[model samples]
Every structure is written in structure tokens, then in C-alpha cells.
Target: MTYPKRFAALPEYAFPRLRSLLDHHDPGGDVVHMTIGEPKHAFPSWVGDVLAENTAGFANYPPNDGSPELLGAISDWIKRRYDVGLDLNQIMALNGTREGLFNAAVALCPEETARGERPVVLIPNPFYQVYAVATATVGAEAVFVPATAETGHLPDFASLPPQILNRAEICYMCSPANPQGAVADRDYWAKLIALAEKYDFRIFADECYSEIYRDTPPPGALEVAQEGGADPERVVLFNSLSKRSNLPGLRSGFVAGGPETIRHIRQLRAYAGAPLPLPLQRVAEKVWADEAHVEENRALYREKYKVADEVFAGIDGYMPPDAGFFLWLPVEDGEAAALKLWTETGVRVLPGAYLSRDTDRGNPGKQYIRVAMVAPKQEMRDGLTRLRDCIYA
Candidate 1:
């Protein structure tokens, strides 16, 4: 049997690969998972009560787009957070970020660029896997740009050759990046938007971790787009309750952009989108409207940040992340380090190479391991101490 050529270049997903590398061995001690950025913190205490009250709505087919109340909540959140107001037509709730991040490419990426060349999707190395899969689904060329320590762990898309930029149609950017946790600054967003304006491409800004920062709130793409007077359609913003409210299981998120761009996305949502269940939608509305829970969640992450800094202090190459919950710690070889850490200390982590692709310059993630800071404070400290004594010490 033959498969589509598009996915032929794609590698196996990350977690299964990690399992293959570590699961066969007996754990050396009490298992402490420092892999997978699944938030172990508590979610809003009211979420259950809200879900119970809205259970009747579950019987009906949920709104194909977000429910009116949910969209209103999302709009108000955007206005409050990004200072970019949006009409009802400009926003749609997603099952979670993965669906929007993938489907938007299917809806928005052109088959061919204006230059009549195959469309190129610029993806940051060590990216959330959905971006590359989305590019493949669209049959576009996926150009993997390095987001290394040298580049401040953000993709330098502006450095790409004119030819690559000219053929580009979509660029996936994650602020408060997943594994590395590097937040894109306002200046970075402005420059990327300008580059998109000049080259005729769209920016897919995934800000799922926007609320999990240590100090200042990260500047958002839409915020910069509006201030710089870039096209309203230039950036498609994706954020969710997953990290912000510790509601990853809630599977609630939204994509917002220009009305025309959103119309195209909503058209696809009508067909292939998995709209959030209506009860979940009601909960999402309530959660989006409230900031108290999010602030409390950020405080927890800030404590984790302090723990990481204190643990890894004086370790060479241990630059702390600006935001998000993962620590991309430097190692001699990611797989070897991860395996040794697991077998010797029972601290499980993901090898950085699993999250990145090999390029002409070689795999940028080859010498690193991504440790999730999502565990409890004391457990994380224990895990980090074991990992350091095992791998780095």
C-alpha cells in the first residue's frame, strides 16, 4: 500500500520515540516524570461546578462556530490582553490549539505562491509537531529554521534568503516556546510582521504559554501587529486554557484574525473542525472572562522558575527560560543523557532531538534534553538534583 508523499518526510512523533528509548529499562528509583509538559498544577476550583450546570447544553449540537457567549468572552479577553479588538466574525473556538494550528494551514496556505512556485511554510526547529504536519497536509515546502541558543532560541526568519521568503506562505511561531520557553519580544513580533508584510505571508502565532511567564506578560503578535499598523490578516493568533488556566484536559482554545481569514477558517471548521462540546464551551466562556485563576496559575509557574534557577545555577549553558514550563538543558547527547538520567536516577525527560529535524547544518537539538517544569515544586527539585548529579555533574 502506498501513502501520500507529503508525510513521507515526516518522522515518528516524539513521545513514542521517548518510550522506545527508556521504557524497556527498569527505573532506577521512584519514577519522577520530568518529560511531557502536561500541567500537574490545579485548575480553577469552579470549573467542575460550571461544567455541571451546563450539562444540559451537551445534548444539542454545539454551535459550529463558538457559541455566542464563548466568542464574546474570547473577544473581551483579546481586547483586555492584546488590546486588539475583534468582531464576532473574527474569532472561532477550537478543540484545542492542535486543531486550529493544523486546520488554519489547510484553509489559508495557497497551493502556489504569487510567483507560481510551490508554497513554503517556514517552521522553527524544535517546534510543536503540528506545524510541520500542517505544512505537509498543505503540500507546501517546510523550511526548518534554527532557533538555537545563539539566536536567543527564537527563529530568525528574517535571515532567510529572499528566494525562500518570496515563496513563503505561512510561518508558525510559538511565543513562550514549548520546550525552550523563549518568549518572542515586541520587537521580534514587529520585525516578523514587517517581514510577512514585505513577503506576502501569514504568521501563525501560537501563544499557548503566554500566561505562564515569570515576570512581565509577554507582548503578543496581535498587539504588535495593531501597534505597527500591519494587516489585520497578517497574524493568526492561537491561545488556549491549557497552560493559562491549567485546563489542558478542557481542550478549549480559539483562533482569531481578520474577518476574511477567519471566514475561510470557519468554512473549514464547518466541515472538519471538532468544535468544543457545548458544556465545555460554557466553561470556557466563564474561564476566559476571569483573570483570578490565571494569575494564580502564573504564580505557581514563577515558583517553579525560581526552583529551576536555583537548581541549575552555575551550571554552564543553563540559561533560564523567559516563559513556559520546559527547561531545554544542554547535554552532550540528548538520547544518551535522557536514557542515563532515567535508568540511573529515574528522572524521565525528552531528548531535544525528538522535537527537531535534521538539516544541512545538522540537528540543532542533538546536544540537549527538554525537562518539563510542570511537576510539583519539591518533586521537581528532587528530579533536577538527580538529573544534574547523573548527567551534568
Candidate 2:
């Protein structure tokens, strides 16, 4: 069988490999799962009621581009959050940002962007799985850029050689970055936007975790791009209701960018993508337009951050995240530390090595573990205390 060569070389999914490593072992104490970044906060009380009101719409087919009402809600949210206005034509409803992140490559990344060479898709070393998969799906060369402690936990794309940048077709960035929780500031976004403009590539900002953070909201990629006056099409920002409203099951997100880029993405979605159902879109509309619930949710995460700080204070190399809800703690070997945490303290965390791949220098995540702060405040504190004592102590 002539299977596709692109995926044949890819590593197995991270979670399945993790399950194989630990599923057979019995936890030594009561289990505390600090692995996946699934938020456990309360969703808006009106979600169910809103869905019920639009239940009849479910029988009808959904528009691929999303209804005008939903689009308006998304646009309004962007305007309020980032102080940037976007036309409805420049936004497309996604079943989830996951869909937009993966599909944008297929729709926007060309077979050969620089003359006659296979274009390169730049990804952070410890990037969302979707980025690498998207690059592979489009038959582009995937270049892993080191985003480690050395680089303040963000990828430095501007440092790449001009040849690679010239062939670059896409760059994936995550703000309030997953696992590390390092938020990219305006300078970072401006620099990246300039690079994208210089190379004629697009930037895919995976900002699903943008809302769950400490202190001020992270600078948005689209807003920074606009401020830098780069070509609007050079940046496509993907955001979702999952983290914002604690509604992962709702599976609602949107892609906003230049009209031409969005038009191409919407055209591709028409043939291969499933839009959010009418009822779900109705709920998404309200969710995006409301900020009170989001503010309350941020306060909850803030409390968790304080808990982590108090628990891990005085420990060596314990960096409180600038934003987001994960702790990428340094250790000698991520896998060994995770197994020890599970066996001794019954606190399960993801080995950082599982989230990253080896590169020319080394796997940047070879000596860390990713602990998600997604439990209730008390439970989260217990988990962090156990983790600190079991590992760092």
C-alpha cells in the first residue's frame, strides 16, 4: 500500500504513548490528574437555555461561513478585546480552532511559495500537535524552531537563516503558551509580524488559552500585526470558546484575518469542513459577546497561580507563568520525574519530552514536566503541594 509518506514518519500521538507508559501501574495515593489542560470551571448558566431556544435550528443545515449573527458576535468580541475592527467577510466560524489551525495550511500554504522550492512551515519546538500535522498535511518541510528557557519560552523566528525564511509559508505561535504559560508581548508579536511580512508567509496564532491567564490579557497577534502595519493577510488568529467560557464541548471558534485569506479558508471549508451547528452557533454568539463570566473565570485561575507560588516558593527553577494555567517545571528527566510523581504522590503530569521532539541542539523539553492547573482551588493546591514535595523536595 502506498501510504502517504508525510505522516508515516510522524511520531505517535502523545497521550496514547503516555497511557502505555503508566496505565498498568497503580497510583500509590489518591489520584490527582494534572496532565491535560482541560479547564474545569463553571460554564455560563445560560448555555443550556440558549441551546434549547435554538433547538429547532438543528434540523436545518448550517451555513459553512456561519450565520450573520454569529459572525457579528465574533467581530464584536474582537473589537472589544483587541480594539481592532474586522469585517464579517474576514472571519469564518470554525467547529473549533483546531479545525482552523489544521485546515488553514491546506487552504493557504502553497505547494511552492518561494520560486520552485517546497515551502517550509516553521513551528515552535514544543508546539501544538496540530501545527506539525498541518505542515505535514500540506506536504511542506516542517522546521522546528527552539522555543526554550533560553528564548524566554518563545520561538525566535527572526534568527533563522534567510534561505529558510524565504521558503517559509507559515509560522505557528501560541501565546500564554501551552505547558509553559509564557505570554508573548507586543514586541514579540511585532517582530514576528515583520518576519512574516518579509518572507511573505502567514502566522497562525493558537490562542485558545489566551483567556485563562494571570494579570493583564496577553497581547493578541492580530492586533500586534495591525499595529505593525504588516500585510493583514500575513497573520491568521484562531481563538475559541473552550478556554474562555470553559465550554470545550461547545467546539466553537473562529479564524479572523485579511479578507482574501479568509475567503480562501472559507472556500476550502465549504468542501471539507463542518460548520458549528445553528444552535451551537447561537450559544457561541452569546458566549463571545459576554465578558463577565470570562472575568470571573480569570479570577479563579489567578487564585490557582497564587497557590502554585506559595507551594513551590524557594524551590529551584520554579517559574510562575506570566499567563495561562500550566506549569512547565524543570527537572533532570521529564519521564522519570513524571513516573516518580505518579508512583510516590499519585499526581500525574505530562512528561515535557512527550510534548516536544529532538532537534539539532537537543529536545528543549527533555528535562521538564507539564502540570496543568485545571482543578478546583483546593484540589489544585493539593496537587501542587504534592508535586513540589514529591519531585523538588
Candidate 3:
């Protein structure tokens, strides 16, 4: 059994561990799940019709990268959103950004740095688990950079010692960060791109939650990289229709970068990737081209944001998210708080420690619980109110 040892140090996935901790106990009241980030909003009304119209295409093999029409729609969306024009060669479709995020690392991260050291991948401490898994898959050293409140909830790669940065091959960043819901601004993106350029590393920008904002749109990584006049290949952008269009089940996303970067990624995808089914591709083509439904989705989230604010009002240390839908709320101990909430109030949440690993500075997420704001506004309001009365009151 000479299996790979890279995942040996990795903790079990978050949700299963949450179940082991809470499932045996009987819930004290009616159960209300506010754990996973799956959206409950209605997807576009015409999605079924579109899928039906294209069902015949399912009999044929899908285009490996993306159908030209789907890719064109993605490119057009990017142009409108980021003001950056991209050639079709610079983008490829993804089943979901999860695979894209992992595969991009395998396709882009080097076996060793220029100085002959094992490559280092910089990951925000409380990161999407796939980032660490991808780093491990590629045999790179994972450097967990704390993206706590003091760091504006974003990893500060520039502060790491030059020795660490010198061996860095990839840096993973998520705007509208998953648990914390922090958006990286233009200055943040510019500085991060500059650091990648200085250290000769590439930035893997996960912008999946980019569209669900309250105010202005977040500055995109690719746009910031272009605005800063850095090498176009210095940043790779990964985005999806999941959060943006309430289409998580659609499993449509895209990876875009310079020609060389995409060439390598698409080449790997040809052999190992499962292209989006032609019917699904046709559905996505029309979905990406339409923003009316996306605007409606954002409006719904805005209402939920207001509900959360009113429910948690006047609570000390309550920092409303800049964008995205999760609330990383403070607690004395995340696991204890989550269990108590579940057993006493029947409200489910994820323990922050499950999303983070212990480090010399401590497990950054140990003192919080992540509450997803993805349920319908009224249910979310009910959940938040119960959570507030149970914990804060």
C-alpha cells in the first residue's frame, strides 16, 4: 500500500467532522440548517426550458475546453464585469471551480523552485480546503498565512520573509472570501500581483463569490493585474455560475489566464477533465449572457444582509461582511458553541476550527462559528434571531 502520503497531515473534510460531533445528540427544537453555503434562491426561470431545448446535444461528446458559444459568453461577461478583453484561447470551461482550482495547481505549480527548493504555495489560514489539497497534490510546501481581522481578512503574502516568498510558486486568494466574506480591493490585488511578480509566482484568484455584493462590485484580480501592468500570466482567474447565478447544480465555471497558462491547463483537461455536457453547456451559454436574473439574486441577498444586521445589531464585535453570504461570528470556542446551539436551539452552523488548522500562532478560526446566509430571507432571519437569543442574549 504505497499510497500517497501528501494528505496524511490534512484533517478530515469539515462537514463530516461536524456530523460526528453533533449528529448523535438529539436536537432540542425544530432543526434549521444554516451550515453549508449552498444557495436556496431560485435559479433563472428559463433554465429548464433552455436545458430542454438543447437536450439532443447530450448524445454527442462535448467540446473539451468549452463550446465556442459558451466560451464567447464567458469572455463577454468578463469584459463587462472586469473591463478586460480576453481572447477565446485564454479561457477554458470547468465542471465547477472546485476542479478548476485543484487542476490549475497541478497544471501550474512547479515541482521545485528556481533555487532547487520544494515549491511553496501560500494559502490563507482559513482557506477553501481544496487550496491545501491542491498544494499537497503537487508536492509543494503549504504556507498558511493568517488572514485574521488584523489582516483585513485577507492573506498578507508580502509580509512573509523573503526566504519563504523566494520559494513560492503559487498564491491562492479568494475575493469575497468564503467564511469571512471579505472582498480584496484594488490596492490589495495590485500589491498581491506585485508580490507574485517579485517572487516569480502566480496568483490563483478564486472569484466565485464576486457577484453577490451589497455595494459596488469587487475589483477583479485579472483587471487589477492588467491595471498594474504586470505580466498577464502572473494571475489566473477562476469564477463560476454557482454563487453568481444560483446555479451551483449547473456545475459551470471557467479558468482564464494568458495563452501559455491556459494552453497548459486545457492540455491537462483534455486528458483528465470531464467537460460540461453539451446540454449543460448550452444552458450555461444563455445563462452567462443574461445579467437580469443575477441582479435579482443580488437584491435578494441585500435583503438578507439587512435582516442579519437588524438581528445582530448592538452586539459587540459584530463585523458585517463586505460581500458574500457567510457570517464568521465570534464565540468563546467554535466547536462548543456550535454543539450547544445545535442541541439547545436546533440551529446548525460550522465550527470555524474545522475550516482551519492549528499553527504556531494558533488555529485562527477556533474562536468563531461560520453561519451561512443562503437560506430564504425569512428563514435566515428566523435562524439568526434564534442564534442571537441563544448565544448573544
Candidate 4:
């Protein structure tokens, strides 16, 4: 049997690779998982009530794009959060932002540049794996740009050559980034928007971790785009209730952009999409409208942030994340540190190199490990203490 070679270059996903690396080894101590970013917080107490009320709707097929109620709720949230008014047509409900992130490229990335060249898709190194898979699936040249400590953990897309920028169709960026927790400020968004406008490309802003910040809410790409008066189609924003509402299993998210861009996404989704069950859509509608639970959730993460800072304090190269839950701690070698921690301390972490691709300068994540703070406060503290003593000591 033959398989498509499009994905031939991709490595086994981060978790599977991790299992292969450590599952066979006997853990040296009590196990404390600090790997995956899956949030362990309690979701709103009313989710079950809402699901019960809407259970009957499950018998019916959900709207392909989204129920009118769900879309309206998402639009209202966007307006409240970003201060940008958007018609319901400008948004499409997604199973999760991950699904939308991958499919948006299929729906919107042009087959070829206007100059008849294969388009380039810019991705930040140490990126969410979906970006590279999406780029390769679309047959675009995937240009991995470094987002190391030197660059403040955000990719400097403007530094690329004019030739690469000219053929660029999309760039994937995560603010309150996954492993590094760097948030893009207004100036960063403004410059990126200007670059996109000058080069005729779209920006896929993955804001899944946008709600888990420590202090002032991180500025959003959509809000910044509106301020700059850039083409709405040029900035496609993807967000989710996973981090915001502590409802990762709820699998609720949305993609919002200009009407034309959404039209294409909706068209592709109509054929290939699995609409959230009507019951789940009803649950999402209510979830988007409620911020009390979200605020409570953010407060918990804020407390955890303090715990992390206190734990890693006085450790060199320890940068407390500006926002988001992960701590990208510097190490001599990510894989080696992770293996040592797992075997000696039984506190599992993901090697930074697993999240990044190798390039000429070397993989930016090669010398670090990503530690998620989603466990309960005391448990997280205990794990971090063990990790610090076992590795940093």
C-alpha cells in the first residue's frame, strides 16, 4: 500500500515521541506529569445544566457554520473583548481552534502567488505543530523563523528577504505563545500588520492562550488590526473556550475575519466540517456569554504564576512568562534534561527541541524544557521544586 508523501517529512507528534522516549524506562521517583498543556481547572458548574437543557437538540443536525445563537454570542464576545464590531457572517464556529487553524490554510491560502510562484508560509520556530503540517499539506514552502530569547520569543518576520516575503501567503503566530508565554503587544501587531499589507499575506493569530495572562490582558491582533485600519481579511483570528473557560474537552472555538475570508472557510467546512453537536453548540453559546467563570479561572492561573516565580527565582535564564501557563526553562540540552528529570525525579516535562524545527542557526528550543503549570497549585509547586532540585541543583 502506498501513502501520501506530503507528511513524510513530519516527525511523530510531540507526545508520541515523548512516550517512545520515556515510557520504556522505569521512573526513579513518584511521577508528576508536567508535559501536556491540557488545563486541569474546573469548568463552570452550569455546563451540565445547560447541556441537560439542550440535550434534545442533539437529535437534530447542527448548522454547518454555527447556530445563529452561538455565532451571535461569539460576535458579541469579540466586540466586548476586542472592541471591534463584526457581523455574524464574519465568524465560523469550530470544533476547536486547532481544527480551524489547520483548515483555514486550506480554505484561504492561494494555490499560487500572483507572480506564479509556490507561496511561502512563515511559521515561528518552537511553534505549535499544526502550523507546519498545514503549510506542508498546502504545498507551500514552510519557512521556519526563529523565535528565540534574542527575538523576545516572537518571530521577526520582517527580517526575511524580500523574495520570501513577496511569495508569502500566510504566517502563523501564537501570542501568549505556547511554550514561551510571550505576548505580542500593540506595536508588534502593528508592525506585523504592516508587513502583511505590504506583502499581500494573511496572518493567522492563534490566541488560544490569550485568556490565561498574569496582569493586563494581552492586546489582541484583531484589535490592533482594526486600529491600523488594515484589511480585515489580512488578519484571521482563532480563539477557543479551552483556556478561557477551562473547557478543553468542550472542544468549542471560533474563527473570525473579513466576510470573504469567512465565506471561503464556511464553504470548506460545509463539505468537510463536523459541526459541533447542536447540544454542544447551545452549551458554547452560554459559555461565550459568561465571563465570571473565566475571570475566576484566570485568577487561579495568576496564583500559579506567583508560585512558579517564587520557585525558579534566582535561577539564571529563568524568565517569568509575561502571560500564559508554560515556563520555558533554559537547560543545557532539552532532551537530556527532560530524560534526567523523568528518570531521577519522575517529573515529566516536554523537551523544547520537540516543539521546534532545526534550521541553520540550530533549533532555538534545543537548550530548554517546557513546563506546564496546569496542575493544582500545591501539586505544581511540589513538582517544580523536585525539578529544580533534581535538574537545576
Candidate 5:
């Protein structure tokens, strides 16, 4: 049997790689997991009630794009959050942004650029894993750009050579970036939008971690595009209820862009997508409409941010995240630090190298470990303290 060769070069996924690295070793102390980004905070109290009320709807097929009510709710939320008014046609519900992120590439990325070359997809190094996979699945060249400290932890698409830029079809950007937690600002969005416009590529802005910030909401790509008067289809923004409402299992997210962009995405989803169950869609509708729960969730993460700051204080190269929950702590070697921390201190964190690709200079994540601060306050504090003592001491 033969398999597609596109995925041949892909490395093992981050978590499984982590398991292979440490599972056989006996932990020296009580185990405290700070690995995956799953939120442990409470989801909205009303979710159960809403699901119960809508359970009957599950007997019927769900709308592939999204129920009218759910789409309207998402549109209203976008208006409230980004100050950008969107027609319902501009939004398509996603099982999760991960699904939409992958499918959007399949639907939007052209097989060949105007120059008649296999289009390139620009991905930030130390990126969300799905971005590279999506590019590969679509038969595009996946160009990994560095998002290291020198670039302020965001990919500099403008710095690419004109030849590469000319063949670009899609650029994936995660604000409140996954491992590094760096938030892209308004200027960054504007510049990226300008570059996308110049190169005729679409920007896939993964704003999944947008709401888990300290102070001041991060600027959004859609809003920035509107402000700059760029083409409506130039930016496709993906957001979710996972981080916002502490409902990762809800698997509810949405992709918003211009009508044509969404039309293409929704058409693809109609045939090949797994629409959210109607009951879950009802739950998402209610969740998107309510901000009280989201605000409460953000408060919990804010407290965790403070705890992390105090724990890592005075430590050189410890850059406090602009927003989002992960702490990208500097280390001599990520794999070694993670293994040692697990075996010696029983604190499990992800090796940063697992999240990034190697370049000529080096893997940017080689000298770091990603610690997710998603456990209960005391548990998280304990884990961080143990990690600090075991490694930094």
C-alpha cells in the first residue's frame, strides 16, 4: 500500500513526542501536569441547562454553516468585540478553529499563484501544529518563518524575498501566539494586511487565545483590515469559545471573512464537514451571547499571570507574555529541561522544540519549555514553584 507523500516529512506531533520522551521514566516526586493548554476553569453555569433544553434539536440534522440563531449570535459578538459589523453570510461555524483552519486552506489556497508556481503558505516557527499540516494537505509549500525574540515573537512576512512572496497564497498568524504568548498589535496587523494585499495572499488569523489576556483587549485582524480599507476577503479570522468561556470540549468556533470567502468555505463544509450537533450549537449560541462568564474566566487567568510573574521574577530572558496563558520559560535545552523537570521534580511541561521547526540558525524553541498555567490556582502555583526550584535553582 502506498500513502500520500505530503505528510512524509512531518515530524511526530508535540504531545506524543512528549510522551515518548518521558513516559518510561519514573517521576521522582508527586506528578503535576502543566503540559497541554486545556483549561481547567469552570465553564458557564448555564451550558447544561441550555443543552438540556435543546436536546430535542439534536434529533434533526444541524445546519452545516451554522444555525441562523447561532450565526446571528456570533455576528453580534464580533460587532461587540471588534467594532466590525458583519453580515451573517460572512461567518461560518466551525467544529473548532482547528477544523476551519485546515479546511480554509483547502478551500481558499489556490493550487497555483498568478506566477504559476505551487503557492506557498507562510507559517510562524513554534506555531500551532495544524498550520503546517493544512499547508501540506493542500499541496502547498510550507515556508516556516522564525517568530523568535528578534522579531518580537511574530513572523515577519515582509522580510521574505520577493520571489517567495510572489508565490504566497496563505499566511497563518496566531495572535497571543501558542507557545510564546506574544500578542500582535494594531501596527503589526496593519503591516501584515498591507503585505497580504501586495502579495495577493489571504491572512488566516488564529485568534483562539484572544480573550485570555491581562489588560486591554488585543487588536483584531478584521478590524485592522477594515480600518486600512483593504479587500474584504484579504483576511480570514478564526476565533473560538474554548479559551473565552473555558469550553474547549464544546468544539465550537467560527471563521469570518468576506462573503465570497465564506461562501467557498461553507460550500466545502456542506459536503465534507462535521457540523456541531444542534444541541451543542444551541449551547454555543448562548455562550457567545454572554460575556459575564468570559470576564470571570479572564480574571482567573489574570491571577495566574501574576503568579507566574512573581514565580519567574528576576530570571533573565523571562519575557512576560503580552496575553494568553502559556509561559515560554528560557532553558539551556528544551528537551533536556523537560525530561529533567519531569524525572527530578515530577513537573511535566512541554519541550518547546517539539512545537517548532529547525532552520539554518537553529530551532528557535530549542532553549525553552512551554508551561501552561491552566490548573487550579494553588495547584498551578505549586507546580510552578516546584519547576522553578528544580530547574532555576
Candidate 6:
């Protein structure tokens, strides 16, 4: 039997590959899990009450696009957070940003761009796996740009060859980027939006980690686009309650952008997607309308950031991320460091290489390890102390 070849060449998913590497080893001490970025913070107290109140809605089929209340909440949140206006038709509730991130490619990417080519989708080298899969799903060229320490942990899309940029259809950028914790500033978003307008491509900005920052909130792509007078049709922003409200299990998120782009996405989704249940949509509306819980959650991440800073201070090549909750620590070889740490200290972590791909120059993540600061404050500190001593010492 023949199978689709598009995914046949993809690298193994990171976690399974990690299990293959260290599953057999027994830790010498209490096992501390610093691998996945699952939040350890408490969710809003009202979530339960809202879910209970709306339990009756679960008896019937839910709206696919989103309930009017939920859509209004999303629109209100966008206006409050980014000062960007989005009509109900311009926003569609997502199962999660992961779904939006992948499905947007299928909906937005053209078979051919201005250059009359298969079009290239610009992806960061150590990027979220979904981006590349989305690019390949559309039968476009997946061009991996290096987001290395040298580049402030963000890809320089402007550096690409003019020919590639001209044919570019979509570029996936993550702010307070996953694994790296690098936030895109106003200038970064402005420049990328300009490039997207100049080349006639769309910007898929993953702002899921937008609420988990240290000091000031990270600037968003849509905000910059509006300020710069770029076409609203040129950008789509994805946000989630996962990191923001500590509700990854809720699978609640939204995609907001130009009316036409979102209309296309909603049209495609109606045929292939299961919308958030009415009950869950009620919970989401309340979640977005309230900001107190989000502020409390951000404070928790801030505490963890302080712990990371204190633990790794004076250590060479240790940089505390500006935002997000992952530490991309430098090492000789990520896999070797992870193995040594697990066997010696019983702390588990993910190799940076697993998060990235090898390019013509090199795998930028090959020399680092990704430590998620998602454990509790005490456990986070303990894990970092153990990791620092075992891996860096």
C-alpha cells in the first residue's frame, strides 16, 4: 500500500524521541520533570462555576464558528490587549492555537505566489513542529531560517534572498517564542509586517505565550501592523488560554484577522472542524472578559523567572529569557547533557536539537537544552539547582 510521502520524511516528534533516549534510565534522586511547558499555575476560580452553569448547553450540538457571546469576548480581548479592532466575522474560536496554526496554511497559502512558483513558507529553524507540517500540507517549499543566539533568538526574514521573499506565501513567527523565550519587539513586528505587505504574503503570528512575560508585555504583530498602516489582510494572530489562563486542557483559543482571511478560514472549518462546545464557549467568554486571573498567572511566571535568574547567575552563557517560561541554556551537546542530567541527578529535560532541524550551516539548537519553568516555584528552583550542578558543573 502507498502512503502520503509528505510526512514520511519528517523527523520524529520530540517527546517520543526523548523517551527512546532516556526511558530506560533510573534517576539517582527524586525525579523532576522540566520537559514540557504545561503550566503549573492555578486557573481562574470562576472556570468551574461557569462550566457548571452552562452544563445544559452540552446536551446539544455547539456552533462551529463560535457562539455570539464567545466571539464578542474574543473581540473585546483583542481590543483591550492589542488595541486592534476585530469584528465577529474576523475572529473564529479555535480548538487551540495549534489547530489554527496548522489550518491557516491550508486556508491562506496560495498554490502559487507572485513569482508563479510553489511559494516558500518561511519557518524558524528551532520552530514549533506545526509550522513546517502546515507548510508541507499546502505543498509549499518549507524554508527554515535560523533563529539562533546570534540573531536575538528570532529569525531575520528580511535576510532571505529576494527571489525567496518574492515567492513567500506565509511566515510563522512566535513571540515570547516557545523554547527560546524571545519576544518580538515593536520594530521586529513592524519590519516583518512591512515585508509581508511588500511581498504579498501573510504573517502567522503565534502569540500564545503573550501573557507569560517578565516586565512589560510583548508587542504583538497585529498591533504593529495597525500602527504601521499595513494591510489587515496581511496578518493573522493566534492566541490561546493555555499559557495565559493556565487552561491548556480547555483547548480554547482564537484566530483574529482581516474579514476576508477569517471568512475563508471559517468556511473551511465549517466542513472539517468541531467547534468549541457551547459550555466551553461560555467558559471562554468569561475567561477572556476577566483579566485578574491572567495577572495572577503572570505573577507566578515572574517568580519562576526570578528563580531562574538567581540559579544561573554568574554562569557562563546562561541567559534568562525576557518572556515565556523556557530556558534555552547553552551546552556542548543537548542530548548528552540531558542524558547525563537524567542518569546522574534524575532531572529530565529535552535536548534543544529535538526542537530544531539541521540546516546547511548547522542545527542552532545542537549546543543547547530547553528547560521549561512550568513546575511550581519550589520545584522549579530545585530542578534548576540540580540541573545547573549536574549539567554545567
Number of backbone-clashing residue pairs for each candidate, in the order shown:
0, 0, 0, 0, 0, 0
Model 3 agreement with the true structure over 90-198: per-residue lDDT tens digits: 9999999999999999998888888889999999989999999998899999999998999988888889999999999999999989889999999999888888898
Superposition TM-score, candidate 6 onto the true structure: 0.99
Local accuracy of candidate 2 as per-residue lDDT tens digits, 1-393: 677787987788779877877888888789999998888999999999999999999899997889999999999999998998999999999988899999999999998875999999999989788888888899999999988888999999999999999999898999979878899999889888888887788898889888887778898998898887888788899999988999989999999999999999989998999988999999999999999999999999898888998998898898999888899999999989888888888899999988888888999888999998898889888888888888877
The global Cα lDDT (0 to 1) of model 1 is 0.93
Please estimate how well model 2 matches the true structure, expressed as its whole-model Cα lDDT.
0.90
Q: What TM-score goes with each of the models?
A: 0.99, 0.98, 0.99, 0.99, 0.99, 0.99
Q: Give the C-alpha lDDT of model 3.
A: 0.93
C-alpha displacement of 114 in model 5, angstroms? 1.1
> Model 3 clash pairs?
none
lDDT of each: 0.93, 0.90, 0.93, 0.94, 0.94, 0.91
TM-score of 4: 0.99
- For model 5, the superposed segments whose C-alpha errors exceed 4 Å read none
Which pairs of residues clash in candidate 1, taking residues 3 or more apart in a chain or in different chains? none
**What's the lDDT for candidate 5?**
0.94
lDDT, model 4, position 160:
99
Expressed as tens digits, the lDDT of each residue in 1-393 for candidate 4 is: 999998999988999989988999989798999999999999999999999998999789889999999999999999999899999999999999999999999998888999999999999999999999999899999999999889999999999999999999999999989889999999999999999999999999999998888889999999999999999899999999998988899899999999999999999998998999999999999999999999999999989999999999999999999898899999999999999998998999999999999999899999999999989999999999999998889
Off by over 4 Å in 4: none
Tens digits of per-residue lDDT for model 6 on 40-75? Answer: 889988799999999999898998999999999999
* After superposition, candidate 1 runs with Cα above 4 Å error: none
Can you give the lDDT of residue 363 in candidate 2? 92
Local lDDT at 32 for model 2: 93
